[model samples]
Target: MPATLLIPLYRDEVAPRFDLAGEALLVHLDADGAELSRSSVLLAHASSEELCRIALEEKVRVVICNGIDDEFWQYLRWKRIEVIDNVMGPVDEAIARFRADALRPGDILFHRSDA
Candidate 1:
């Protein structure tokens, strides 16, 4: 099964916000990770509640987001959905970290503005 990525729509590195749900949900069958279109990320419009619900319904194994609200994070944790917080990178790089085991469930990755 492919790992799923949940991203914010408005951020530079995040996938583009498209569709009524407003987020790019990349589901690829590569353990190494897959590249996604910047125009297809639509996470900005969806609230934490909505995203959490989406993750659950989609059976998303992983979520890489710019930031996470406390309530949403807690909910996701309860659901056993791994979250990579404060992630800053291209979609592929983040997924690489996950595949390499360099990224942890509650990791606080830094996406520098300079990067």
Candidate 2:
């Protein structure tokens, strides 16, 4: 099946904390792992439960964020969503690494945005 990746977003970068993010980037990757579409969603509020609900509602298959709480992490995993946490960088770069299968938890791909 094709997979959808959700990334908690803060401004132009990955949100530092998942539960605190008020917006998210939803990326749909085709069966071949090419991007099918990308959308940004603004939430009514930020919370772990809200994030989970949105993910489930959107049928997201993967989640990539900078930091996530343990309970939320476990919950997402339990729901069968692949969670790649602690990744820090510009949203585009992170997604690039993800598509290339080079993204890992705690990876800081971009050191500066002004470069």
Candidate 3:
């Protein structure tokens, strides 16, 4: 079966911090790089515990988020969920890079104001 990815969202972009996000996006992608579906979930609040619960409940295989707490990061990894952390970009671009096997930890696909 194809894998599912969970991404915390902030205004159509990857949330800057996982624990601070109040919204989430779940993406289902097939092995052939086709997007099966995409949906947004409004979180009850910004809580890592709640987020982890959803991930587990949804059987998410991968998580793409920006900043994440060390403890929570370790916890997800321990649960066998692959986390691609520190990804700063629009949701579509991020997923594209992931599908191409080009996305990496700390990937910044959005325009950098510092440039």
User: Candidates' lDDT values, in order?
Assistant: 0.58, 0.91, 0.93
Q: Which lDDT tens digits does candidate 2 get at residues 1-115?
A: 6889899999999999998999999999998889999999898988878889989999999999988999999999999999999998899999899888898989987777686
Model 3 clash pairs are none
Could you say which candidate leads in lDDT?
3
lDDT of 3 by residue, 38-82 (tens): 999998788888889999999999999999999999999999999
lDDT of each residue in 11-49, candidate 1, tens digit only: 445432212235555554355454432224355465667
Instruction: Give all TM-scores, in the order shown.
Output: 0.62, 0.93, 0.94
- What residue pairs clash in candidate 2, if any at all? none
Candidate 3: misplaced stretches above 4 Å? none
Alpha carbon lDDT of residue 85, candidate 3?
Answer: 99
Worst 10 residues of 2 by lDDT: 106-115
RMSD of each: 5.2, 2.1, 1.3
- Prediction 2 TM-score vs. true: 0.93
Residue 86 displacement (Å), model 2 = 0.6
